[model samples]
Target chain A: MIIARVTGTVVATAKEPKLEGMKMLLLQPTDASGQTAKGSPVVAIDAVGAGLHDLVLYAAGSSARQTEITKDKPVDAVVMAIVDLIENQGGISYRKG
Target chain B: MIIARVTGTVVATAKEPKLEGMKMLLLQPTDASGQTAKGSPVVAIDAVGAGLHDLVLYAAGSSARQTEITKDKPVDAVVMAIVDLIENQGGISYRKG
Candidate 1:
């Protein structure tokens, strides 16, 4: 999963029935350099109680549907975890690494 | 979907087969108030060309696998669109609303 920071939230009164309780978020694309990219909103999931400004990792597709809250909710992306650190072969490029 | 901002992207030498050439972006979770939340990485499918600080929309699960580039990949999140604006019952709380 790509590292990201929380930006904002969205609300929709007119939507699908199964999507009632689902939490959707708007995401800005970014790279490892911590630079933003060109993109739009992402109706992502909030599984781990992510708040604004926190860096997080999100998932999508059928796996998103696999969540207990999102099952059959017409959802695609779901916030699965909150990142405290990130490390790799590069050795401690990011921490919380 | 919640509104989020793009933070960064990722590169992995070891990954799934169907994920070759797929663009993955890092996202930060946000609320309607434009606040960041807690979370981890979000390896999303990039459809629209979104840069840093740009808002984007992403999908997940089997639908992410439905993409031509991500078919059968182990990926779960995919960036589907770049949001220019977001409007709702609140009467344009967010713009580009």
Candidate 2:
């Protein structure tokens, strides 16, 4: 899984039926320090009800569909977990609360 | 799906039983021009019969398990298609044959 931040939202009126009620969020991949990663942001299906700026754990490719909400959907990325904290290299890299 | 080139192979004798007999390949993500992508090479399970240096389409996330061979497995990435060509901007960006 990749650590990312829910930067924003996306509303696609025209999409596959399987994605009808799924929430799409703009995700900015983040390093352990919670800084923006190098790659361009990706649009991911929100499965864990993460809010804007919330740190999240997202899965890409086929793994994105493993969630019950995204099963059989054509979605390629999904926010699977809401991260509360991240400790890296014995240092507090990030914390939500 | 992301486009990638199979670079090498991996042999893991100890793994989940569901992964028995599955082929693992090292993949280098590629651009439309077939150039190496920025991220580090990833280890992916081959769902299709792709060869070394073969350009392939891979799905990551839960979708990786959607295939018959990977269903219920802990795999995170799968090579799903062999690419014949990649045409971009009205130009032939890549071709296999």
- Residues A49-91, model 1: lDDT tens digits: 8877666777755677777887655467778887776565676
Q: Kindly give the number of clashing pairs for every candidate.
A: 86, 13
Query: Residue by residue across A5-93, what tens digits does model 2's lDDT show?
Result: 77665443333334567776666678987775746455678888898878899887767778899887655788899999898999899
Worst 10 residues of 1 chain A by lDDT: A32-41
Which is the leading candidate under lDDT?
Answer: 2
Across residues B9-90, which tens digit of lDDT does each residue of candidate 2 receive?
9999988888899999999887655665746799988866788988776667776776677778998887766666654434
The per-prediction i-RMS, to one decimal, reads: 7.3, 9.3
TM-score of 2: 0.55
- Supply the TM-score for candidate 1: 0.50
Best by DockQ: 1
lDDT of 1 by residue, B1-97 (tens): 4455678888887977666777778887554333455355465766556677666555555665544455567777665455555543234445543
- Candidate 2 Cα outliers beyond 4 Å, as residue runs: A1-97
